[model samples]
Target: MGTPVAKIGLVPCSGEALPAGTVCRLACRRVLDTLMSGQTVAICLPLFIAGGEEERGFAARHPTITVDGCEKRCAAKATELFSGKPVRALLIPDILAQRGIPMPTRLRGFGAEEEAAVQAVAETIAQAVEGVVAQAQAQENQHGAV
Candidate 1:
């Protein structure tokens, strides 16, 4: 309720089905804290999907970045279904592949390598957040001019 619409919404995949899901969640937090700081807010995947209308309404009106744990893309799919718009989707495995890093297998504890992977995912998300903010600013500026 305290979250503001001006902040970019980060919807991380809530799939407990795999370790990749955990990766996305952790990476989302890292990006929010280090990269976005006060510029972003998280829309919990579980809550956003079946929680309340306020969240859905907020996502519909604001820019959202969906971080998917895998190809299923639960977060991205939910965002598009509820918000009626495509989000800036970042897939964790794909990010790692792009950097030529191997995917982690363990599901629980984040070891050194896992943490590094999370950082990589967070970095990619950070870059996307910058673009989202820039585009939002441009849209506001354009509307203000009109």
Candidate 2:
């Protein structure tokens, strides 16, 4: 009857171990940016196995877009294991690897360079989610008119 609603989410594979300090916080900011633009987004910080389980449940009920900082695939695996819904995983390491963005040898907090890196990765993930939402809306329009 109306536009198809899309609930988006971003999740990191490892929270505490993230060399980029407050990377999850940065991810939250990216989600906020989407919401500011009149899009809906949910962010779940899975600090432990139990939290991951909860996130998986939330993702199951909604079409969630998960983003991980590395190749650990923790976020995607958790979402799939708990919710049985496969996530559109945005592995930061994979992206950086593709762009030839060098990896930091030492783990540290979010700095200027790391911030920019995360921003790029986060934006890429957001764009993909937007596309999916748009496609779903288009399909709804097509079906409703028929």
Q: What is the lDDT of candidate 1?
A: 0.81
- The residue ranges of model 1 lying beyond 4 angstroms of the native Cα positions read 1-5, 144-146
TM-score of 2: 0.75
lDDT score, candidate 2: 0.61
lDDT of 2 at 143: 87
- Model 2: residue 88 alpha-carbon error in angstroms: 1.2
Error of 1 at 133 (Å): 0.7
Local distance difference test scores for all models: 0.81, 0.61
Using TM-score as the measure, the top candidate is 1
Model 2: how far is 93 from its true place, Å?
Answer: 0.6
TM-score of each model, paired residue for residue: 0.88, 0.75
lDDT of 2 by residue, 1-146 (tens): 54355565555554556653245446556656753345545546453355565565656666666666666667677777666554466777776678776654446555677766666666676677777678778888888899
